[model samples]
Target chain A: MSGAGHHRNAELQARVNRLLDLAESRGVITRGQVDARIEAFGDRVTARNGADMVVRAWNSPEYRERLLADAGAAAAELGHAGGGYSSDIRLHAVANTPTVHHVVVCTLCSCYPLAWLGPPPAWYKSEAYRSRVVRDPRGVLREFGLVLPNSTEVRVWDASAEARYLVVPQRPPGAEELSEDAQRDLVTRDCLIGVAVPRLPAEVSR
Target chain B: MSFAVGDRVRVLTMNPPGHNRAPRYVRGHVGEVVRLVGDGRFPDESAVIGDAARREDIVTVAFAGPELWGPDSHTGDRVHVDLFVSYLEAVGERSDGGRTR
Candidate 1:
């Protein structure tokens, strides 16, 4: 089923590219402008920069406090806050501890924190995920292969309002020995989404 | 529309003709109001034809896993969902009781 879905998606993408080429030739929208727009959009919503903020917070307590208190300003301090549709949207940071974990979903539509995190993955927008995550969070997380202890609370942030949430995952043990750049590399998008925890060197290697 | 931070409220399942952000899983499920997030322009009527939604006061509701799922869920686990005002309907202490918010 997954393979078929990917094949269909690839075919649709080819069709879209063909349409885009025809549109550009017809002078409907310039290819240069479209390229520029895609670039601008990418810069505005890419999650790589947001991961940097999380890494910085992990290394610094002061920044973490600021980020938790006011995520929008904290992101702007790193020159990654405001963008295309972010003028009206606010970002919220939810920290995870040994006792708590955070995940985000949009039940109604695919409302996402595009400013901090780039466009959401296609899986995040799927009706199956969006419907099930809110109803059965643990089941959904388990499907992602994340099995939390019974004592750990799983917090699911619904991105319904103009606000978006970014999960601040707990720093793994032995991370203090690593450099800031190394630490940043461990903080993948899945970690920020609360599906997967940050890995140590051994875990990464395995 | 007006409830304390810890007040338990059930989300209404209204199939109105507009852009609503409430999820199907949470509709009719009771949860505690965790935070009284300030108002913003509502999104339901705005995103229909490309009009930007104005922000409205939205409350963050926290639900225990047992309440949402069943007793088989993790004991101490809870999920926090940010819900708009349109998605909620207040339930009192005398109402049908099952989940502790």
Candidate 2:
């Protein structure tokens, strides 16, 4: 970044630090709690958690059924309970089929399934993406290097409420041949957001 | 629940000057209630009255892409928006906010 931009960011960080100190001293919030939350977001809660659930669903039909029925309960079943600010928040998984593609966005704000998918990409919060995805999802996906066939049905989930969405990308060809760990590696954060799909290394050529 | 799954509902067009959860794009638009997402504290009033605001039902409304963006929207595409119960009414129901809210 430019020197001026770096200086501006440092100034903003110092202001946030002052606010944190004031909040801590006033007993409004504890430093330990703040640290724990940051730690959770940075490490404990991540897209790998979503990948774990997806891999389990791919391996077992019963688990997949359970996930679709009650995604919150299913996440807890896999020990990846959607933990964050509110217990009222619900996670809904939308699976991608050969003829159907499911993408998620919160037009008003970036209400993401962060507990499962980790932090949202910067572009997910951009005005261009937030507005256009709901309008021309297929076109935006094309920009993301995902070109769905004209016949495919695109479903854009606008998470304007408490219900957070997770896109269960279809396991790619040759994915079944890979081990469980290999399969999880394919399900990146983008895959979980429905911007892109998981693919085997060999399939990259297509 | 005021609305059941698969019911055709239309979002109310009333523009409350307070914090409204119903996005402008969906106001006065018609969609199908796909899921009954259990109620939460009503966001609009809660924004003004705080937590004391009554909890109300919310549902997933799936609108056809064409209905939202007209010709620019691709065929066979849809946008599903989660809307509070107060912001919706039965398709033929009068578009009066007082009746629902």
Candidate 3:
């Protein structure tokens, strides 16, 4: 479970361990608490939560309206109350249309929708991604293997405040015939982050 | 509370020594207000004052790539940042006076 194996930042790893040690020695927090929080993030809180919301919205027009209108409330409707972090941290869903695409980022820091979509990927927290995505979104999307058409407007959401964003990608073609669960399978974590779009099962293998 | 959706505004250019959430990339740039994300504890005050810090309204501002990064940026791309009210100032309308504000 430790990142010392291939994390590439031994100095930061040591510092984090030192801080955790200090907190433990001072009785501020027990190791069990830390492990529990990690386990929760690693297991209970995953992208499946966001996929559930996205899947529901795709199936029902009224739910889609509610999701776009008030994402936090709609998330709670599906049991993702988005609790734990500051109550002010609101979850907002931005749906990608045929002409407009949406990507989320936090230039100041990695302010992701952890409560609804689990922790962000490591690349998302890197300085390279943070700084470049805002300035050259199309280029970065290309690096992610997402080549949008010139006419498709890219909307990069820089989550600089407590407002966290969840990108609701439009359901891909050939997926409408699939069941709800199958459709949810197509909505991968990258799709939720907007770095990639959902692909049909057959397209994925190709 | 001061600005609404479609309001043309500019990010105040300042190098305040205090803690601020406004990123350096957005400072001094012009943008249009898009969404009003409800009030929350102002980060500048919260950094020094903690939970008791004064609250302020936060709004999402849409910045075109050209305005932030010049011509090399993709023509159809845009960045939307959620900035506090204190970090923005009214720039009235778009300079072109033709684009939808």
Candidate 4:
């Protein structure tokens, strides 16, 4: 299924269009408002915000301490406070240790860290991913091209509550030689989600 | 009842008639309290009563893969779930009907 609600079945599309029309006619909300909201989210709340946090944490131990303690406030300090429509939303940062790795999923629905990461990917909202990731995390990570050692423990986080999860992957070696902007580029969305780790340019070449 | 971090708790095996946040797979499984994830409005009650429901404590519980899915699961994998306190109970006391641990 498309994450942006595109290419759906015609019957479902028609029903959704009817509901939208009815709501617009009753002054519930306008199509323009909906478009504006999506645009705002795309522009302001993209995954780059999460990359920025990870990059900052990579450089500053103080900021990393603050982020792990109060993720919501730390995000807000960087101007990425993204609760959107609910005051109940909270962001939690789970750091990867030498023996432990963290990956997040929402089993019931597509609940994600939308405030910091903007919209979720199409695969994240799929039934196959939601059902299988918790059961066979290593298999799923393998499919994503991540092969962890048997000694390393995989921790699959099933997010069923209002709190959102962000994975803080270990910084790649030789990251200190790069500029801040360069470091940010290595911290991709996949790295932030813990499916893949950031790789230095030299490491990638090797 | 309140539980400190590192306490062992088991999820209640329940199939309630209304909306609930606890997933079916983790029901009746044992886990350790990893962190207290703050309180929020109870999903089951809030889904029925809307804004009038009371808030409840939430925690991040970590369960071994083998404990949840049996021996076929990965050897060193663990699953962490953010669950309401109401969905948990003393682990050893449930099946045996013995005194609370």
Per residue, candidate 4 scores C-alpha lDDT tens digits across B1-101 of 78889999989989999999999999888899999988999999999998799999999999999888889998799999999999998665456674333
Report the TM-score of candidate 4, chain A only: 0.91
TM-scores of all candidate predictions against the true structure = 0.85, 0.91, 0.92, 0.93
Q: A86-169 in candidate 3: lDDT tens per residue?
A: 889999999999999999988898899988778878788878889888988888889999999999999999998989999999
- The residue-by-residue lDDT of candidate 4 on A30-89, one tens digit each, is 999989988998798788999999889989999999999999999989998876577887
Residue ranges of candidate 4 with Cα displaced over 4 Å = A1-9, A202-206, B92-101
Q: For candidate 3, lDDT tens digit of each residue in B1-101? A: 49999988888889999999999998888899999999999999999989999999999999999989988988798999999999998886556874333
- Flag regions of model 1 displaced more than 4 Å: A1-4, A14-28, A40-45, B48-55, B95-101
Error of 1 at A117 (Å): 2.4
- What are the DockQ scores of the candidates, in order? 0.58, 0.78, 0.86, 0.86
lDDT of 1 by residue, A1-206 (tens): 01115658778989999999999889899878988988976766676777888998998899999999998899999998665654557788999988888898887778877767776778888878877776677888888878888677778888776678889988889998999888888888777777778889897788
- By summed lDDT, the worst window of 10 consecutive residues in model 3 chain B runs over B92-101
Off by over 4 Å in 3: A1-8, B93-101
Indicate which candidate wins on lDDT: 3
The true-versus-predicted C-alpha distance at residue A39 of model 1, in Å, is 3.6
